[model samples]
Target chain A: MTTTSASNAGFAHGRALRPSSKVLPEHARGHNRSLVLQTLYRSGRRSRADIARETGLTRVTVSALVADLIADGLVVELGQREETRPGKPATLLDLDRSAFVIVGLDLSEHSTFSGALLDLDGTISARAEVALAGSTGEAAVEKVVALAQQLVDQATVPILGIGVGSPGVVDLGGVVLSAPNLGWNGMPLQSILNARFGVPVLVANDANAAVLAEHSFGGADSDAMLIKIGHGVGAGLLLGGTPLFGSRFAAGEIGHVVVGTDGGAVCACGKRGCLETWLSIPNLIERLEEEGDAARTAVLREAGERLGIALAPVVGALDLSEVILAGPTELLDGPLAAATVETLRNRTMAEFHGSVTLRMTTLGQDIVLRGAAVMVLSGQLGVS
Target chain B: MTTTSASNAGFAHGRALRPSSKVLPEHARGHNRSLVLQTLYRSGRRSRADIARETGLTRVTVSALVADLIADGLVVELGQREETRPGKPATLLDLDRSAFVIVGLDLSEHSTFSGALLDLDGTISARAEVALAGSTGEAAVEKVVALAQQLVDQATVPILGIGVGSPGVVDLGGVVLSAPNLGWNGMPLQSILNARFGVPVLVANDANAAVLAEHSFGGADSDAMLIKIGHGVGAGLLLGGTPLFGSRFAAGEIGHVVVGTDGGAVCACGKRGCLETWLSIPNLIERLEEEGDAARTAVLREAGERLGIALAPVVGALDLSEVILAGPTELLDGPLAAATVETLRNRTMAEFHGSVTLRMTTLGQDIVLRGAAVMVLSGQLGVS
Candidate 1:
């Protein structure tokens, strides 16, 4: 399926991205600083004067912030600009990609714990993975730490921070409240990583991470939602550019919502007729194995319809425009994708709305790692 | 029914209230100005230095902003505050509640077109209502204009703006895309009122307006959903203190979401399983009239459970903590409320998050009008 993932702020219609007249003076300078850095990050190399003119900041303020960035090893003085439409040739400043590396971990992979060392621009510099062997508790934690350490050791530059995307609900403080697959309950992942490496750490739900990755790198419309249907089903909702952490940080747990209603198959959550039971890859594959090729498409289409049923109210309530799915594209595309779009259109109020665009993930398997990198970038540099 | 309506930003957990470090230099000063005004609006009265301390603004900046407010007639200098700390007594500044009057219209009231003139603090200064007699087309539009003009004529203070909360799917630009009840289709409400009154005007769906009113006047949690179940069923979603007016401005059209699986009554939209078909007050009342007291409770409870099923994924997706039902307490409380809560618990990811608190609106019947008042305030002055 053709995917349309623009910036998260696109679907928000200038709500989240628009700066209002309700900020304080204390935050003004910081906001300007972040703005300057964001422009530079998004636009690649730009001179101080160019940034000043673009951001409408005084040359002096931009120069001062640039100085601070360079002093902090974030920006580097590059060669002179082309000197077009200026009195003098201005020296361009660039994000020093080699100065810092971020360690990102994706624990959502069913049988493996994957890690990657990413540069400032989210380029994967090094990679590592550990076969999980279906371990939980201390063993799972140990495997995660080992994978992180391997990526950390492989880093060729200063480690900016470490971000882990685990399966389950996570609190604002990066505490893993629960991960059924990992057998994790109230795991202090951030503290553990922070203490182990003596670096800043952020741990978030894998689905939330995937959404962040989509927003930062995958071109998600600002107020869009990302649903990841692998071994487990969960959603990542981005309102404006920021993720909706919900009141309890369990905002994106859509897998266990009852979809079958009349109780078909029992789910791992001890519930009959859950969304996960209908849509999970393992369950679908199992169902497909018993059916013919023609029946496979029908089964996947039914699963897609079920998924759409579970999400229709959400789309109706939130008016989220873009619904992106991430998983094995083969099973998610064709008849399944068509059925999902049909169901969504059938469910939402199409009189006022056109139709919600359905797309497949562009980042694919590396979505979580890139999302974790984005988490580190937002937490450490205040930029996404 | 117990009601809990805290300040709108309370449930947002400082997300919308906290000034982010991503604003532009052009918006910084305006932001600070809004911040100072918002503080005064929320905290009642405070001195310049006190505002500085609360807002982290310099004394000179606060004094300058306050002076501007006073000049604009949006604020007034009150008597000196008592010297609690060791310093000279400071004159306090307060929002001039009588400086501006907002005309608010509520079209959701069954068989009536109600209008009110409200002061800056949302106090109803004058009220007007016309029994609709189930009118539509040009007649309905004429009635709305007459009611608005009556409120405008009664305004004693300077009129700030007019806001209309009509029952429909309104686009972000204040166009009534569709209002089945009022026989409206693509009505340019904001433009019509603006041209007539020669002042600012905001037009929104009644449910959206109700949510906005809840957020601005009734102290709704920033991350909350308000379900307005009267003659029709609809919802208003507040994400990060702003109304979620989906990409096509159809964010809260929840009533039409398919709810009944076995295909019962057909909806007004030609759907057989819409939530509105099962849960609209008129339908519930008719069903109650046929049943005994025990059966009445069961019917309401079943309706509530169906509503909850339609909303569970939304609650799970948004992780919203506050769910407020706007309608008669007689039909919504007791068994209905309990069933809704129970269904939400059974459907949401309770393994990680706690139960979402469901409550009746504290603003009662005036929610849409109050919401219209809030729309005018936010549009004119960017407050709340």
Candidate 2:
């Protein structure tokens, strides 16, 4: 195995350059400690009292946890607050940005491998990508490992853990049950990566990871659905700021739901009338190619309408505030976006009226990778 | 208002008869307290130490909470375990079954009104049914209230709260957004009941409630989907032991999902090709009535097949453990059930390979009522 000098530097810097603090045990104490850290990380600078009030933890407990965090160099006390609230000024606490680095990996059919080095606050410090010669599981894994190593080598902070987002069903144990595009099944991805990198690894479905990224970085308030209209159609549901993973981890598999049960084109998954059969990038591209410019645009617009109809139940049930679209702008923008809005407005309860907003992802192609980094942060910090 | 002495007696007796030396809170507390109570309720009698270990709460905190509970006569300390495992004999604790009673009400078009009175542990102690005279919103609500009052009066325990499950989109505040059968739209149910009866009221979509009831009472060990096939086709999703409410509180509106884009019957909701349009009881009956006995059976079987096709994506994505059919047994049992199983097996991933079981609801006609009762229990005890 090649020695990852950058990984060592990141770890050393994370530990030495910042502060030497013992990691808390993952019990009740750890839960509170992580909550404090997360609050500071999310809110930028929150006083110990503010965290205590927000989290419902006692002020004494927050003080103790904050003291421990400060002693460990994971948090820093920034003197006193500038704003006054009719009382003594409170001491604002902020996360030590250089305390840890999270490595994120995104594996998609279009993009073989993309990796990012994120800090404690989820700011990407470094990134790298590798093209795959062939779109196969083995080839993809190999490229991912290499790209991960390169990204790790470039990191200047201490490495905390790694998170990977791949398509298909990912179990709690980080096993990839299946990825149709990669031709993978029952892949022991977590074990392999943990053994290789000597770090904790979390493997999540790409859509779920994307939602996490959006929830944390995109500033979604409460409930939202991140629809990924790429090679396939899938959704990541964020209900009350937490990603919802259904019993079989298929909560958001809207792609396979039959949109046109009879006489629709057969999907790659061998199903007729599947939403993905009509909405997937390849399928849409084929239709566009066959239908010409005006027809293609019309078809894309119609695809969005069908997608809206499909998602009406989701919106109605969850009472979400937004639907974040993550895909190529050429497909998701313009008429497609307008049609989606129209259908959603028509199908949903009028009380929701204009509550749900449909917007394109700001992170662009880097969304999956950023989401993976967010996943790592969430895992390490115990946010979810 | 006519005073219902029997209902008052039920509530008074249920609360006053509880053992005074119990160690669980009388009513729901904050998140942590509720988590502990839920753990005990689900797992059964366990020591405070064991509960702390299972729930990741501090022993001291658990002890304090338990003390508060015991004082309130909600939880009781059982005699010490006869067999000790190389440690101190732990005193087991359990929920006081007589502390509170939950009333569940189910109102559907075909089924006018049904209900059950459930104890703290979710054991149904009393049940009642009343015919619905009209399908309008006000008429249905009046019938439901009368039936609920009847069940409440017959109850031999103190009532804590009431839960109502109807076929519609319900909000957190117990308002029904729309129910085509009942002709309800934006009905303020919670406020209406709260005004009449000084107790908490929970309103949920029938399918959502069914999923919860199935998870807790239907012997479902993993994530499962409970499809309620009565006058309409609705689905309830239990994901990770919790009901998976989508973004808009309309997560399980599988009925409105278009199964056929063209040449399908128009739904009462003004949509075409809805699953309910093709597979609902009225539709099935109409097809059977027109086609004769042979075609009727064939249509039922075909309906099951179509359902399987519609549900294939959910199975593939969620890796669902089972699909429970609840409704008229005459339609869902035998050939229809068999056809559903066959289609599901064929369409899903081979590796899942007979993993998803197709079963019928054991509760029969009371499934919806019991589900509604479960919803009340969940809300009263803060489990959902």
lDDT of 2 by residue, A1-384 (tens): 111211211111111111011111333465566667767776778887798878777899889888887877778877899875687888888988887788988886575577888776667788788887665777667777888899778877677788888888777667788786777788878777877887777788899888888877887654778889888888887654556666566667677765534447877768566678778998889889989986867998988887775666555444566888999998889888888878776655454434678999888887887788776665665442
What share of the reference contacts is kept in model 2?
0.29
Candidate 1 C-alpha lDDT tens digits along A164-232: 889988886677888877888888888787788877788888998999899888888988999999999
Clashes of 2: 31
DockQ of each: 0.45, 0.25
TM-score of each: 0.90, 0.80
Candidate 1 regions off by >4 Å?
Answer: A1-26, A81-87, A292-294, A352-354, B1-26, B81-88, B133-139, B217-219, B289-294, B352-354
TM-score, structure 2 vs. true? 0.80
- For all predictions, the C-alpha RMSD in Å is 5.8, 7.7
Q: For model 2, how big is the CA root-mean-square deviation?
A: 7.7
Task: Provide the lowest-lDDT 10-residue window in model 2 chain A.
Answer: A11-20
